[model samples]
Target: MEIPLSHFEEYIDEPLLKRGLSYFKNGFVHEPEEIRPGDYEAVVEGSEDYTVKLSIRNRVITEHSCDCPYDMGAVCEHVAAVIFYLEQEELGLTQNTKKGSIKKAKASSSKPSKRKTLAQQVDDLLGKATHDELILFVRELAAKDSLFRDLLLASFAQYNPNESKTLYTKQVKTLIKVARGKYGFLDSSGAEYVSNELSSMLGLANHYIRKGNHKSAFFICTAIMDELISALEYADDMDGHLTDTIYDAFDTLATIAQEDPPEEVRKLIFKYCLTSFSKRSFSGWDWHLNFLHLAAYMLSTDSEMEELFKRIAAIPKSSEYEVKKAQEIQYDVLLKRKGESVAQRYLEQNIDNPSFRARAIQDALDQKDYEKATALANEGIEQDSGYPGLVASWYDWLLKIAESQNDTERIILYARYLLLKSHNPKRDYYQILKEIVPPEEWTNLVEAIVQEAMERKPYYRTDLVASIFIREEWWSRLLDLVKKEYTLDQLAKYEKLLAQHFPSELADLYAERIIRYVENHVGRSHYRTACKYIRKMIKLGAREKADEVISQLRQTHYRKKALMEELDNV
Candidate 1:
C-alpha cells in the first residue's frame, strides 16, 4: 500500500512504529534527498546501510521499497524511518531524551569504531567455527526451521541431491501447509510469501537448466506447475503472485523446450504438456492453450502432428482472444509440418482470424501484391465489422496501401474515418489527416470532422473535440467546451493546457465545478478531492477565488466535521 502520509504511523504495527521512530530520532536516515518531485531516496542505517526508495503521490505513500531483508510485514522499519525523516516537519516530530539515547551514546564514545557488516560478521564466525560444529549447528537449525530446512535443501541441491520431481513437490506442499491458517486458507500476505518461496525454487530450476541438467529443471518446473494449480483453490492470490508463479513455470518449460533437450527429457515434457491440456488443468486460462503451443514445438512424428492438430481443433471458440490464439497455434503446426503453401492455404480459409488475416495482408504487401492486399483488407473489414478495433486495423492497412500507391484521395478517406472511429491510442490519425489533406480545403474539412465528433455522446465527444481544439489552438472553443460539459475531473485534466491562455476563465470554471461537486458528493474523500481542486485554483493565480470556494464549503458543509477537518488542511 498506499498510506496517507499524515497518519502513516497509525497503519504500522506499534512495535515497528516505535523502532522506526527511534531510528528517525537517532538520525539514522542519512543523505535523504528528493531525487524527484514526490520521489525520495535515502541511506537508512540499520544492521547495515540500506537504500530506501519511496514514491509519494497526492500526499500518500503510493509505493515504498528498501534493500533490507525485512519481509515479515509490509512496511519495514528502514522504510518507515526514511518516511519519518522526510515528513519530520509535517509530522511535528521532536527528539525526546529516550529517543535520542542512541545518538548520545555514539557522541559520548571516544573510540567509536565502525561496526562490521552482516556479511563480514558471518564470514568471521564461519572461519572461527570447526567443520563439525558448523554441521551440528546447521542440522539443529534445519530441524527447527522448516523454511530454513527447505531453503538449505534447495540451495545446495548438488549435495544430498534427490533429482526427483516429488522432491520439489513435497517441498512446495510443506511451504503451502506452513503458510495456511486455521481454516486452511492462505491470506494475502501468506500467499505472497508462498509465491516468493516457489519463485526461488523456479530460480534453482533455471540454474539447473544452465548447468545442462535438463531433467532436474524439467522436474522442478513441472512439479511447481502441477502443485500451484491446486494450491490456488484456497489461497487468496489477490495480488496475482501465485498466478505469476505459474506463468514463470510455464515460461521456464518453454525455455527448456527451446534448448532441444535429450530425447527422454523432451519426450517427458511432451507427454506432460499433452496430459495437462487434456485434463484441463489450466482451464479458463490462456495457459490452457499455451501448453498446446509447447506441445506443438515438441512434435516429431506424423502421428504426433496429427494428434496435436486434433487437440487444437477441439479447443472451444469461447472467446475472440482464445479463438485467435488457437487458430494461430494451428497455423504454426501446419507451417512446421507442411509447406508454406499449405499454411498459406489454411490462413486464406480462416481469414476471419485477425492474426492470420494481418499476416496474409502483410505477406501480400511484402510481395508488392497491392491488389491481393486490398481485397484481403476489404474482406476483413466486412467480416469483422462488429469489432471496431479490427475494422480500424483493416482501414489502417488500406491507408498503407493507398500511401504506397500515392492515392491521396483514399488516404484522406481512410485517415479521416480512423480519426473519428478508431479508439487505438497509438495511431496518430489526426496528424495523418493534417499531412494528407490539402491546405486550401483543410479548414472546411476540419470543421466537418469537428461536427462528426460532436455528434458522439458527451462522454466520448468532449475529450476528442477538446484535443482537436488544443492542437488547432482554438483555446476559446476549448474553454467553452469545459464550461458547458466538462466534469470536475475533466476540468482538472485539461486545466494545464488552458491555464496559461485562459487562467481567469479556467479558475472560474473550476470554482463553479468544485461547488457543484461538493453539492452532490459527501465523505472525506470527496471533501479531499474538492479541496484539491481549490488548491489547483490557487495555483492558477486565483487565490481569491480559491478562498471564496473554501468559504462557501465551510458555510454550507459546516456540520460535516470530516469535511471541516479536511478544509483546515487546505
Candidate 2:
C-alpha cells in the first residue's frame, strides 16, 4: 500500500516533515547513541551528492541542512529518507538504551555494504506494490513516491485505452493523493449511485415492460422499494444524510426498476421520502430528491412533476393532503382517480388550513360555482387581512350575481364594499368590475372611468380591460392611449406579427400597449417582462437600442444580468 501523509503521520511525529524534507536532498551524519550508547552522529545519504546534518532538539529533528551542489530548493529526499527510517524503525526520542543484538547486527550489516541501486529502487516503487503501498512509497519522497500515484488517477480519464492510455505514472499517484483529501467531495457519488441503480432496475423492469415484463420489473422494483421504506425509518430527513448502507442498497435496488418501473413504484416513493419507516437510524443524503423524482417522472411522464414538487416542498410540512408536498407527488392519483370536483372538496374541507386555503379558493373559482367561489373568498378575507383580493374577488362575483337577479341595491352594496375595502382601489377590483357588470348599475360608468385613468396598462393583459374598452366604443381613444405607453419591449412582439404574416396597424399598437403596461407593472404579474422584449430586440438586430432600453428600463439588475447571460449562452 502507498503511504499517505495521514498514515505516515500516524507512524511518526509531525515534526518529521522538516526532517523528511532535509533527508530527501543529502546524506545526514549518523548518530547511533541510542542504537550504540556511545556515538552521537549518524550519516544519511541523499539523491544529490551530499551529506546532511541533523540537530535533535526536544525529541524533535530540527536545524537540518543539505549540501547538494544544486540544492537551492533546500529540503531534499535524503532528509526525507532519514525521517522515514526513524519512523518505520520506531526510534525513541531522547531515550538511549543498551545495544540490543538487532542494532549491533544492523550496525555490522550497514557497514560499507552495496545498497540497492537507484534504478532498481525506481522499478520496485512502480511495477509491484499494492495501491495503498504504492501511495505510501510515493509520499516517502521529498517528491514522495509520485511515480505510481499518477496511474491510479488515470482510471477517471475519459479517453479509451488505445487513444489516451491511462498508465499509472508518478503524476497520477500525486494527484490521487491530493484528490482523496479534497476533490472526492465533488464526485456526486450520491447522485450517481441512485442513477445507476435506477438504470439497472429500469433494465430489469424493461424486460418485463418489453415482454410486457413491466409486471416482473414492477414486482421486483416494488419489493426493493418496500425494503427501502423500512430502512429509511432510521434516516435523517431535514439534513439528508443516509448512514445505513441498506438504505443506499435499497435505493439502488429501487432504481433498477427504472427500466420498466410500474405505477406501484411511484406510489411507494413517499414512504422513502416523507415518513421514516423505522426511526432516525440513518443520515439523509441529497440523493433521494433526484432519484425519487426520476422514478416518479419515469412512471408518470408528468413533465410538470419536478416543478410541482418544487412548489409543494416550499409549503409548510404540516399542511393537509391537499396542501402538502406529498400531495404533489401523488397529484396524478388525486386528480385522475377522484376528478377535479373531488379534489376541490378535499381542499375545501381543509380551508381552515393556511396551506390548503388558497388552493381551495382557486379550485372553486375554476369550477365556475360563483356562489361557492364567493363564499370561499369571503372566508379567506377574515383570516388574512392583507389578502384583500380574496374579498374583492367575492365582491366582483356578487356584483354580477346581483345584476343578473336585477337586485340593483345589492349591486350597489357590493360595488360600494369593493370601493371602500380594497387597499389598491386605483386598480384590480375596479378593473374587474369595469368589464363584467352592467353599465346601468354603474350609472356614470365610474368603473370604466377609473380603469382608463391608469397612466400605463396592457390592452390584452386582462380580458376584462379589453372587454371594457370594446364596450365603451372608444377605439380611437384606445389607439391614442397605447401610443403614449409604448416601450422597446413592444418592438419585437409587434414586428413579428407583421413579419410573420400581416396585421392591422391597430394590432401593432395593441401589442405595444400590452408590452408597455407589462413593463410598468400595471398588473400584479407584470413585473420582469423585459426578458420577452430583450429577446426580440436582439433577434431583430436592434442590438444598440436593445442594450440601451434594457439598461434604462425600471427593472431588477438580475433581469438585465440574466438577459446578458442568456446572450452569451446562445
Q: Candidate 2, after superposition: displacement of residue 319 in Å?
A: 7.1
Our model 2 lands, by Cα RMSD against the true structure, at 20.7
Which candidate number has the best lDDT?
Answer: 1
Quote the positional error of residue 157 for candidate 2 in Å: 26
Worst 10 contiguous positions by lDDT, candidate 1: 104-113
For model 1, the superposed segments whose C-alpha errors exceed 4 Å read: 1-163, 457-460
Clashes of 2: 78
* Collision pairs in model 1: none
lDDT of 1 by residue, 192-274 (tens): 77899988888888998999989988988888888889999987687898899999999999999999899999989888988
Error of 1 at 564 (Å): 2.0
Per-model lDDT: 0.81, 0.44
lDDT (Cα, 0-100) at 225 in candidate 2: 43
- Give me candidate 2's TM-score against the actual structure: 0.32
